[model samples]
Target: MKRIFILGAIFTLALNWSCGNKKTTEPPVVKPPVVSKPPEAFAGFLTVLTNDASRKIEIYDPTIENWNAAEAKKWSWAPTTALGFVTADINTFGGGTDFKLRKVPVWNNAEYAALTDNGFAAIIEYPSGKRKWSKRLSGNLHSAELLPNGNIAIAASDGGWVRLYASSQGPDQEYYAEYPLISAHAVLWDPKTNVLWVTGQHAITKAHIITALAVGGTDAVPELTEIDSWRTTIPSAWGHEVSAYYGNDNLLWVTSNGGEYVYNKTTKTFSPAPTAGLTFVKGIANQPSGQIVLTRPDYNKNPRPAMNCGLNDWSTSTVDFYSANGQLDGSRVVNGACFYKVKLLNSSYQ
Candidate 1:
């Protein structure tokens, strides 16, 4: 009986050892969850001029998403040696030699054909390889804007006229009218009210004139009524150098060779904004956050002078951000030849 009890005790010990070994063994390997990188932030598109041998129109997308350096995409039609402005549509339009107006077809997407010095009123399609329409103007077009109603608003410098052209029946129908001022250069259309705003130098003097066009008229006659007129408070200075109207604020911002001013349509008063850091401010764009972005001409110096520079040069270009309280929040130096215009792609993007 004693011998049998010993054997049974040994068997019980062996079973306990096997159970312990099984519990100590490793379990199946488990994997970790996959992590995804964040999506890149999209910086607003910028119009830059190429400094290389081509001197072409380059569109810079400052990949704000990934915080990467700006990537430049060039256009086939070069605006070299020309005074021009780049519209937000990635179209570079400017006055060529001898008032020959031209536009780059569209940046990126090679399917579209390029436009090189097409006539004064050539309408190049965005991202499409086709010229929608073109019309001959009475004089050299200094500036042009595409209206929301699919028409083109143009300001002539020599003739001092503002005209509107509508595409109808496969041809551009032109409606032209004379304004009070000759040498009108800048023009814009207010999408909210379909009002056309025209700016130019008074034919007889250095003073500037602003006119509002009568909309929905088959006749090209823009009502010559002056919305606002001003002479440079400073001697021998020009007023109404550049004008932009903000639809959100209903304010008209104008900058001249002398200074910058904002007109409150509600109050019918004009107030001056800070132009100390601005030299030859060419474009005024309003952002979604009630801020303004100003673009200016290029500087000529290396280690480009900061925004505080009093002179206008190729190296002096900057983007100034202004809040609703009329205070400058910050500024970034811009490297581009002849920074003629700055536009906000979307208010929300800012």
Candidate 2:
């Protein structure tokens, strides 16, 4: 009886201890849900200016899901009476298809400067396709730049002239002040320095804008005072185009038949660009993303050589993009298209 009682007591104690040590029934941990971020958006596009009979100015988006030159065009334009402006004369401007679309600056790419091998320079409004100011002048008109004072400067290669017009006089305004620049092919207005840089066949010239003279009145005559000029960096080279280096305010991009170069504004010296030694580069565009867009006549495919700085035949169907280090990154080609120049469709101009 004593053993039984002892055994019973021990079993009861063990049972009690086991019951006490039992882990309290606990619920499992529940973690909060995770949230993910949305994908980033692309922020770049390019403007392709063609010199074909189509005379197309197309906006190309490189960020398309499956990029196709045919489908990549976001918008396009060809001069027509529907644009509310007199169409370029076919006889004078080459088959009414030679509106060489140049700088599309101002109002967030809302305005464009166009010219013909003949005497035609005009600023056309984008989307609406209306003329803000235009003029027919003598000389082989090549490029145009809008001045901060609401005037326009046009470069003519044939007559070696950079003509300034008072845009306030309206589209048909004929009066202009001329500055001689031998074989001038391109003009760019520097808003920061308030000067005009003209690229010609043999030299790059810088001119000071006489604000007092550019009052834009009927009697006011604008003047471009020659501050200085530098000879072509490449020996016997023909300067073709001049554009603001959007990545560097101290530099400007200049292309020539000899090669592509970067002109330092502070030093007034031309240096070989990353794409130096490349010949026949007609147009250049520096992008904020460190890429370089350039156009060169594909003579192999086009089978037409340039005729005395005239680009009527200097074009190809392909526009090339280079990496920041100057490697050929990619190319966009539109079959049967003659791409002469390309500009970045952004508001950035360093």
Candidate 3:
């Protein structure tokens, strides 16, 4: 009876060992990688260049569902309203930063550089609408860009020149140098490459700022040197607007008389943007969240007769918004006010 019990115990131990050694067929589980959520649409304010008798730079909060000039005009800057300021038609809106004062420039405290079609350019403190500097530029002024060295660059379309001013010298300082660019309409300073990108009649040119060395080692003045240029693809091309595609630094959002395009820096090629085929896009910019904001004439709606909508009454009272996927999501309209160019108020050139 003892021998039989011992054999039974050995059999039980073998069975337990076999069960423990068995291999399972199930695969190992994997947790998916964490992805951050995209920012909400129209999260911040949009700075718009409104062309009316006032010729004002208006700020509209996109977060407001129903925004209008009367109710939503919380902040605005009219050159006509400022003391001893030239009442020029507000043309371009570009973001600027005073790195010494603010780490992150917001809509209220940031410095903005703007130009008028009638040869007026100025650097104004936003919200306060105080003019830090003002100059009456020559030719048909289209755009002004603030440089890293506290200088300002102007693109005069009719004169075909890109002018550089030594702004640190003082307000109303004359330009020290000018670069030849036919029908120059837009100027943008690239912080990454330390180059200025200018859009001309038929090409996009890249220029380097050449600062002269003074006798005492002080920087005398800066000049622009053309590095290279890419001829645009549009037939009878007339470059009107150019802005950095914040969604991709390698790409630029360019608008011409024919249509809109995304210029790929890597490939040096031009491709139609999602908003391509849209007409009269005076301004186009990408938000940090990858959405696009733009201004163009809505011909379907007639301009208000009381206001001067400018040249053929082309200016519209609407600012259009597009999703990252190139879909038209929404629009904000300000009655009685014609908006020409729309810019994201935040200082995010990326």
Candidate 4:
């Protein structure tokens, strides 16, 4: 009986010790949720300008989505309507503020000249922002191109002529040449062929001349002699607006009023582009990423003719991005009417 009582006491003591010293398990740890940021509206910088008299050279950085007005380094001093960037100061010719319709540039390469719709024309220097020379042509300045041999070919709408600034003396030396036409609108310098393509209110002319020419083998070189010319002559060409550019690989793209078409040089044929509702294209640019940027003025609210200069007042600027195949990639709108031309520059260029 004594042994049995001692055994029971030992068993109870062991049971109590095991129950009191039971091991406890801790809970698992958790982390808080993470947040992400959205992408930018655009990848690089863009220059936006207006057609009206009250206009500013607005610079927009689409990456951060902000307008950078203070960073603008202009090549010309007058109220600018067209832009051309060069490495040297440009020359200018004085004229009154007699304004008219502005011409859209074919490419935004480093240009040696800038034209103001107020009849002011000037050559600008890049890296220095100096005015080397300027000349007030006979009519309202639409567009101008700096030749390879240090000459300038200007398209003046008032006189319906393309003027050639011939210079054998140097960059500063210049003489003027006038070629009659219905209306000279766009002057483009294609680096690939070293040919200047000039578009007018009704026709597109192919100008060929690497060196300035003499009038009779003794006079100054005309620089640009018309080699070939063709007319789009579409229904829209009746004067609303017309813009053209060598899109890529021997294909020429033309848009007027609101109609767009592609002319294939290989087959010498034309086909309608997929430009459905995009009316009144202001400019066209081919980006390095194989995307084409087009400036579309809001035609619904934009009027064809306004007071004063009687130039069309473009509504809010609408820019569209399209693939090489004419597929609409995306689009965005900017506030303000009288929007003129839109240009894209690599962020690195800034």
Clashing pairs in 2: 90-96
Candidate 3 C-alpha lDDT tens digits along 163-227: 77776566667746777777676777666656677776433433211111111111237766766
List runs of model 2 lying over 4 Å from the truth: 1-43, 65-70, 87-117, 201-219, 229-236, 300-312
Residues 274-298, model 1: lDDT tens digits: 3332323445655444555665433
Give me the overall lDDT of model 1: 0.40
> Candidates' TM-scores?
0.57, 0.72, 0.71, 0.59
1 or 3, which is superior by TM-score?
3
After superposing candidate 4 on the true structure, give the runs of residues whose Cα lies further than 4 Å from its correct spot: 1-40, 44-59, 68-118, 167-174, 201-220, 229-247, 274-277, 299-312, 315-318, 323-337, 345-350
Positional deviation of residue 229's Cα in model 1 after best superposition, in angstroms: 10
**How far in Å is the alpha carbon of 59 misplaced in model 2?**
2.2
Between candidates 2 and 4, the one scoring higher on TM-score is 2
Score each candidate by Cα lDDT. 0.40, 0.53, 0.53, 0.40
Score candidate 4 by TM-score against the native.
0.59
Task: Give the clash count for model 4.
Answer: 24
Q: Would you list the rank order by TM-score, best first?
A: 2, 3, 4, 1
